[model samples]
Target: MSDVWTWPARIGVLLGAGLFLALLVPILVIQIRRYGTTSPARLLGAAALAVYGTALVAYTLLPLPSGDLAAWCAEYGYPTVQLRPGQIFADIRERTAGLPLGAVVRDISVLQGVFNVVLFVPWGILVRRYLGWGLLASAASALGASLLIEVVQATGVFGLIPCSYRLADVDDLVTNTVGGVLGALIAPWVLRWMPRAKTLAATRGEPRPVTVWRRWLGMAVDAVAYTTLSGLLAMAWGLVGYLGTGQVPPDTVPLWLFASVLSWVVVFVLPLATGTGESLGQRTVWLAVVPDVSRVADGGVGLSWSARLRRGLAGGALWGLLQVLSDAATMFDVGALASASNLASWFAAVLVVAVPFTAGKRGLSGRAAPYRLADAREGAGALSTHR
Candidate 1:
């Protein structure tokens, strides 16, 4: 038990788990990009599978007993392979024939045999549950897994290490296969608690009309984009300053000022530059702004260059002011102001949703201007004007 639960081993497991989880981020991002949404059940299932695989791989290969390959090679010879059938059973019978029950139960070899069988049982369960494999399939998979381990041990980890340090036993293959078959046989009972595969697939809910939830999803994407863009820009700026001055760059501009500029660029200037009122969030949600039908006849359909500039400047100024205030409060350690700013931000976010019901389907910004929010008329990311 002490050998199994060492701190180094625990740390290895943790690092493996984290590595698996970190890898999932890009996979999830890809899934979201392709599907325009994610399924919680699929994500959770994939994450769980990754964790198990990582742990298994770590346990099988990490923390090599011998570090100095040359010294290990000099000391240890190639391991003898055990391929004879029933050899393990014969040994077990000879060792336990006259032993008392307690002694047999306490035997380390007996415990190890049991552990080998138990180790592959989860594989069978997972195969049946996640992959929907049948009994033969699970058993075959288990046999393959056992064969791979044996091959690795036989080849000295594919010649990466010095010599074969672990035993390659045929009994392990038999026991593992048996364990997997047994697990498959009992999968119905064991996996009863888990959601069905069909249910998991269905959890990716149908796409509805662009509502508050969809809008919120778009905003979430925008938030990610903003943070990523800001970080990249900051790094680039720092590098440029360092190259020019031959010293580490310092923040010459105040945090509030920097945040204000970033907010204007991210929220207003860039969106207007697209020649659409849709910010990144609105574009992702397939929303657009168009002149209200009632106001289009009143010279609201087309605005002069000066009017467009005023609208962009006004929107940018408001966003910049909010961003600056938030940054200032955070920098000054004003917790109350920071909290208030966060609340205010949420309130402003909800304004679009609330205004639709209260102000006749016009967003806060749209109503103030000459536009209203309109979703894509056609399916699959086609945006059309409200008019």
Candidate 2:
């Protein structure tokens, strides 16, 4: 009995963790783009949904035959389909006949039916409350999803497996759907504290105050994006080289150099050339670099391509140079330069953390450039007013 629950739980947790990690960046990007900010409740709900999804799959379709599929199917001589509804009630009654109420409730058949219903309750709550779907739509969706799961089971995983390993019962469909409808009915109370998508979208374009934390978040995104791009490029080059030449390259200097250049083009050059004056990460997090007009007699207007490029270079050059040197040292096995690069990288991090505490909240880069970071939506409005 413990094995019945433990195996599925373990599988679900492991798969769900992997799925969450894969979706983290995309989830952040989507939240910022759609709502202009992140919500802890929404992120937690998303994580819960991922876990529930994997758990559902694990429960419904796991414990597949290991070997001797035909023999296993023959040994498990249960009906693949149970079309008659209310069979669950009959089974429960037969199994728990003349037993005490407590014993009856604890009966295996009764628990099975209850578990199926409980498993789908979250589906209804998430669909109806989090997604803001109508009750009818949520209920229909739950029924459809339950039907699909049963169908897949009855069809032996869409004919991949030789035969159905579990019963596909009409009773399960009814119970699951009922659970979904019940959940939808109570979702408003359950998720009273959660922000609705509609509410978030309504204020998405409104200007938000620039904060040190927001600045750090944008920078973190930039670092992660740059590192991921460089790593992927290097891996692709290595893969291609291995396929064509039939040997893995011994030296990685060429690959790292090529990757660094391409990543720079993407992370730095593209934003400036497009006149957005924001890195990919900044744009994703709803931040932008705008001209500082505090000293000008007349306020500054929008930045030209050349002006934007100059500002970007000034703000990013030191850290970018350090990154390049680090890559070079790594590729060439230059121990001294690697150590220097590591120290510089730490120093750069300290500056990023410390600068926000200083007057004007300008980091090392911001002080060097004629521009400062602003919320993209707010910055756009400010720029337009000046124009």
Candidate 3:
């Protein structure tokens, strides 16, 4: 079976999932929050506004200047590493000085520049919505923000990450800013591409604007609840292990307590809790319940169960185990923002891999597919139902 799917396909699957979330989360949020108040036209407009607004605010409010970012980079264990852009470029230039112009651009530095641009696409979408700005605005804001962050890092205000962080490259500024603008402009077309998502409007009662704190709380509650399920399952595992071998793995911790903490974190800190509502934990929480209702041409009631079963099975007990395994693999690999220690990577890995099934109903499988939430409203609704 594994042979049937090449590594490229497997990698594509992972990348595709990430890309989907990156593209969908913004629009889904817009539809969920704004659709209820105005026409679908206005709703989308509002969503676009919110996305860009949030991005701008995030850029401004980011704690880069606190200088703690530098110290935060190296907390991971042995074999911890940092990516030095300037050093990498210098090495590249020295090694490939004789290469053709095309080859030079194809080298590591150029490739990294391209990725830097890609990494900030979400920023563009966000900036445009937040500030009523376009691609140029988004790009300008992104460059300014990145530069601020780099300056802070160079200053070592936040700590070690700042210390080892590289040059504030002009190229990075150019690429990242352009990426942001493209994202902003791309938003409307992207939403139009989706099959029309049924949205609630003021007619049904204007959906409350989701506050940052409330959104976070909702996620927190779901995380705790899901983790509880994991705990129960863990107990079942322990009981079976005992029945079969009359022994327990000393290396293992108590399931009840561990799941409790994990679920708690899933709720409070995951990105989904903040907006996307598609964090590994949040996604599982969403799968347990059905989304909103609507009518057919004849006004027949219906349910959008397109991905529900997938969500459910993925969020199930066995799937939870797989979630943990995948997360463990993706931890260091997913977002490796290492301070000197690489603690963030380790923690992220442990959380992604072990957190779900070890204590709750959601696992790696659910996370792999995640909950297909479109906005904060749907996310909240999903959380309520998932529990």
**Highest TM-score against the true fold, candidate:** 2
lDDT of 1 by residue, 1-387 (tens): 666635444654676568656665454554444444545655665666666566555555554556778787667645588889777777878889999999998776787688678767778888887677888888899899879987887778898876776777888889878888887888779877766555544534444355555555555555555556656666777787789999866654543345445754775567766565666666665565554556544655653345445544444334444555565566567665576467547655665355446343444554456555555334433323335
Mind giving the per-residue lDDT tens digits that candidate 3 earns over 1-387? 343223434444455445444544344444434443224454344444444444433332233333344344454211222344456467667867889988988776666666667657767754565334666666778877767655554544344334434344545556667777777778556544322334333332333433332233333334344545556766676777788898973324444334433543443334332333244433322222223222123332222243333433333322333334433334334333223125433443443453334323233333444232233344555445533
- The per-model lDDT (C-alpha) reads 0.62, 0.77, 0.45
Off by over 4 Å in 3: 1-98, 126-137, 160-162, 194-387
- Give one digit per residue, the lDDT tens place, for model 2 in 1-387: 678977887877889888987787778777878998887889887887788889888998886666887788788825559999999988987899999999998888988899988988999999998889999999999999999998888877887767877789899899999999998999999999999988998899987777776666666676677778888988888899999999887656677668876786787677656765677767778777667676333575555655665556554434555676788787888876777577657866776776677545556656655566677776556755532
- For every candidate in turn, the CA RMSD to the true structure comes to 7.9, 4.2, 17.8
lDDT of 1 at 387: 54
For candidate 1, which ten residues in a row score worst on lDDT?
Answer: 377-386
| Candidate 3 C-alpha error for residue 267, in Å | 17
Task: Compute the lDDT of residue 330 as modeled in candidate 1.
Answer: 61
User: What is the alpha-carbon RMSD of candidate 3 to the true structure?
Assistant: 17.8
Number of the top lDDT candidate: 2
> On a 0 to 1 TM-score scale, where does candidate 2 land against the true structure?
0.79
